[model samples]
Target: MKFFQIRALAASVLLAGGLAAAHAQPAQPARTAVRGTIDQVSPTSVEVTARNGTKSTIALPADVRVAAVSIAKLTDIKPDSYVGTAAVPQADGTLKALEVHVFAASLRGMGEGFRPWEGADGKKGSMTNGTVGSVVTTSGTTMKVKYKEGEKTVVVPPDVPVVYLEPGDATLMKVGAPALIFAQKGDGGALKALNVIIGKDGTIPPM
Candidate 1:
């Protein structure tokens, strides 16, 4: 299959309620996001060393999809774009965005909802994945995002890092490169990668 087809399949399968919204049923395999640096790479698998020095060797699928998480401007976020933002709650009840990631069209609505996230400021934050209903640019960039369950109002500051996914190839999987692998643990105690998000030009993916 082609890259776009594979990417669509990946969005439907890998992110099908696997991001902790509802509990997985008995048939769904447990999913995990592995953040680490590439230690080794081979035709079949790649070894990743985590920040704490733990290493994991995960097998790659035949058509492993790779996407480049490149930097974007705050203006890139507009109405109807599917986006995910990590933000901390302000005293006035609005969320302050720490980082914003614009999902590709194929992966839109993949993980649509709000959930708790570990903030960059060491405080408890929130992750909102939804469609932008509206955007206002007065004091700060404010967005009202709507999802299946509910909606959230987020204020994106000027200094927040914004990123978007673009088509990428295996050449980004070189040794010592940072990667975020979405994998499913097999019953045999091994992990198989569903897809990978790699940074472009040293811009690490925040989510």
Candidate 2:
């Protein structure tokens, strides 16, 4: 199967803290992601069924962004791999890992900074992106990551999910395909596509 990747290639925005409300200024090249199943598709529009069972119809522009998704593994992590993780700060000031995402080498500079991350529980945590210097396996696992300004220790528990992205293109656009559509609203009160991330061969996009 062929692959297509959505590369966030904008300039890095270094915040004072984790991706937080404090750094809530709007970005210039803003990108939006809509994760759902494709229900309908045409040259000008698309209909999607969201994960929660809601459906929405969006305009598909000529220059819509399209990418492909693939599966990855935890053992694929190694030294020099650029990765990011949402971490909860421990009482001892270290970081307890919540979720980890590995990036392809093409994304070396994408979001290459740390900031406060909004947790599922309404509390904000931390998000750090850096190259993995080493992985320590003792009780569970530990990833020592180094960024431009500093370093962080990420504690990878036994059951924490780990995955990576792959390079994908726009050819995978089809009905019944699982996709993450990144789009924005136009002046006419309609959602327009920016990025359409698709999965191949009966595979649902897990990212």
Candidate 3:
């Protein structure tokens, strides 16, 4: 698949307690992506264990939102279809796809823009949201999507994970269920989930 070579801003990560001094330096943005199993959950927070064995606790604000993501196919992308692609910049100035997600029509205008993704591990990449203007299908798929800012070209390799979101309930956070969350480590060192993607049944979200 082919991808657009979208421009990017500098990527930085912020840690708690990095600005205690009067002469402190600039603080980085709090963007993170976490994928793991639900170790525990409560009214105030949830504990998750990463596949690599890293564990984190994230505070659940009163209005925490959740969604369910399911696998999609490359053919799922079509002209005028709303989608978002997360990809890393290649040395050749191309956006090499990390993953591709087709959006349900109801989410047409949600988080619609291209910018540095505050993904888990400070995902250093761009996320473009728009309607696919065209699709080139050969070995892989190349897509041209037009957003408010402009257009982006995204290449979707066959191996890239593709998913779409559906309404998810809090009960989807069953213990031992697979999940992924884009959150930020708050000042107190506990992560705060801004959005959550919970897997259904035994299916784990792959983006």
Candidate 4:
């Protein structure tokens, strides 16, 4: 082959190899939410007891973010407010909320959709994160939440936990408080904490 032809062929071969290598790289694991109580907390790690009684120890990174999910009233969720709720389908196809977390203005559009989630009961649940379109209060509170894809009408009982996220620190990691820790499992099965939402004064994180 001519000199120029040989050079071109070599460049193409190198490009193909690079593309193959890129395709072979494994995708990173997605983070999953862990709803449990903090059993122990150290400077480096945290031990949690899942609602089902299983124990998990997740590494706490130096920069791990902590937020307090404090108790709120159902009336706090107003029109156009962003919120997320975990609910289960009821007999009449309406959703019954297990817990609701009102997001701050900065987090308005985060996780805006409805997806399958696990409730406190450890059974099939759906999480809806969206803007509140309307709120009706009669015997109980009902909210019509709208998201990018769709909307859902959720029935919120008076006794269900309603909470909102606020700035928190490591001091909220005290034992016996209900916490929802978000952690990612590595390929080797070790879990590392990402963010944590803890409840204060006997409150439990609803989301």
Candidate 5:
């Protein structure tokens, strides 16, 4: 009986020791992808700037390919938009890329008119005796569409509704096509057309 008790206590001690060792073991570190944009390039090493603007220098490898993104291809993004930088790594763990794109914007004007402008809600509306005008430009949320009728160029403020058609991109728009346009009365009365529709394609439908 004495020997059996001793053996049991020893087994318990060993089990406890094993449990303690297992609990004390270090956890495996999380794996993350090495991604960043290049900032500068050199023969031996490249410098990459991170999204947070931190710069890292990486060594170059013989088998790595270096490439640059075309300015024309980046059309969707505005000019001078910041792209994240990164350093390329070689097989031997050597850094190569001087700059990389952690984040990049498309070049300006490449995707123009592809994205609809604000206020393009597909609601039906109307305008009464609205004058025509050239769009001088847009400011804030208002667009100044100007047109010349007879001797006077009438400036009309059209409330831009949800864009049924984007600017510079004409898609199947015809005169008398159902469209909603904002209009102002001569007495400065302003209201949104909720039901009356107009032909955007150019030919006015018979009244």
Candidate 6:
């Protein structure tokens, strides 16, 4: 009787240890989906704009992969195009993204040549014809162009039409005619043709 009782106690202890080990295991994380536009993207974070016009920022894992949509329905996307949702991988290799999809249209040409004439000295001034060094802003009706002098950055307003040229046409425009650009003073100021013709070759370097 003593031997049998000792054996039963040992078996019970073994079963309890097994149950404790199982309970100590971590629970699986739930999958989620998120949708939004690419507001800002960096090596570690991606900013997106949602359908409700709200912005959502997400952190990127070290193993994150970036790819463009190749389907016809997604052809409207351009390089650096805003994307909605992206799958995030779990430690166990499962993928998940919330149901949200982000959307953003390129506003490349919406604002091309508007400038703020008022300077820090409270005097109104104008930016003259010069080489475009870089684009400071590429969204909405405002674009800031940095000139070669680099002394000041000029604010371009939304008067002159911004056109995206094909590679062939871009070359032609650079060689053919001069493009006219209007100058303005203050924010949303009056626009007047500053240069009758600026060489069409005026292109801002890549940012």
Tell me the TM-score of each prediction against the true structure.
0.76, 0.71, 0.75, 0.75, 0.19, 0.24
List the global CA lDDT of all models: 0.78, 0.69, 0.75, 0.77, 0.24, 0.27
Worst 10 residues of 1 by lDDT: 1-10
Worst 10 residues of 3 by lDDT: 1-10
Q: Where in model 5 is the C-alpha error above 4 Å?
A: 1-40, 71-207
Model 2, position 195, has a per-residue lDDT of: 70
lDDT digits (tens) for residues 47-130 of candidate 1: 998655889999998799888887788889999999998787899989888778898898888678988765323456678899
Total clashing residue pairs per candidate?
0, 13, 12, 0, 41, 14
Per-residue lDDT of candidate 3, residues 104-149 (tens digit) = 8877776677877645444577777788999999989988878998
* Candidate 2: tens digits of C-alpha lDDT, residues 1-207: 433222222223333445655665554443445667888888888899876698888888887756555555566668899987777888877798766667788867656777766642345677888999999887667888899989998888866655565556555777788887767765655688877767766445532
Candidate 1 segments exceeding 4 Å error: 1-30, 119-123
C-alpha lDDT of residue 33 in model 6: 28
Model 5, span 93-166: residue lDDT tens: 33222211211223222212111111112212221111212223233111111122221221222221111112
| All candidates: CA RMSD (Å) | 7.8, 6.8, 6.5, 15.7, 33.6, 30.8
Worst 10 residues of 2 by lDDT: 3-12
Q: What is the lDDT ranking, best to worst?
A: 1, 4, 3, 2, 6, 5
Tens digits of per-residue lDDT, candidate 4, 169-202, equal: 8999988877878787787888998888787775
**C-alpha lDDT of residue 176 in model 1:** 78
